[model samples]
Target: MDIKTATALHRLRLASIPEALSFPALLIFGTGFRLALDYDKLVMPLGIIHGVLFIIYVVLLLDVWNRAKWPFKRVALFFLLAVLPFGGLFGDRILKREEQAGVIAARARKEGTVNA
Candidate 1:
């Protein structure tokens, strides 16, 4: 992998944790606030927030998919994780493992331990 690709992988790994977390939190908070408090005032902001976070997550996912050359099924699974309750955590774990593996591969390639 080139320098930019490796750096992008690290950036994606860092962003995945929070991106995975935000949706669940938003789900709980947004629903509760909508039911218990003001509708248009408070919860609306949360909807917007969720939309923004979701967009960011998708963009990051696409970038990772392109850099990593993930298959269609893997990409779909990750996308599904974004919508499923608590799925983001699972996705985060998978992404961390993937990043670690990628780092290992990159290092091996750099040291000529593995054939390119």
Candidate 2:
């Protein structure tokens, strides 16, 4: 794939991971706030928002993974990150770096700037 397509897919993949993760965290933390701190407040709204984002993230991840032709391992890692708190951010960074590296390598190859 070209660099732009790769980059876009990488972004979508990155975005999907965190969006999928936020819902569970909100549910857990919101529960804590209610039981431990007696801070009952508007939690359902957050839950609703997270739920929507989670679905969006999943769809985006699928699109990106398919277009990018990521290996099976990478695809698995993406799913794992969706379930792990803060893992999405790390995944996003890694994917971006990898995409950039691929773009650079492709450019180098096209220009015959590096030995193959």
Off by over 4 Å in 1: 1-6
**Per-residue accuracy of model 2 over 1-116 as CA lDDT, tens digit each:** 56665766666655755575675668778877788888878477767877787667667777767777778888788778776777777777777777788788778877889776
* Candidate 2 segments exceeding 4 Å error: 13-25, 37-41, 105-116
Give me the overall lDDT of model 2: 0.72
What RMSD does each model have against the real structure? 2.2, 3.3
TM-score of 1: 0.81
Worst 10 residues of 2 by lDDT: 12-21
Query: Candidate 1 on 1-116: residue-level lDDT in tens?
Result: 65456566667666666666767677567878778875646566777787787788788878878977789999899888877766777787777776677777889988999998
User: lDDT (0-100) at residue 43 of candidate 1?
Assistant: 68
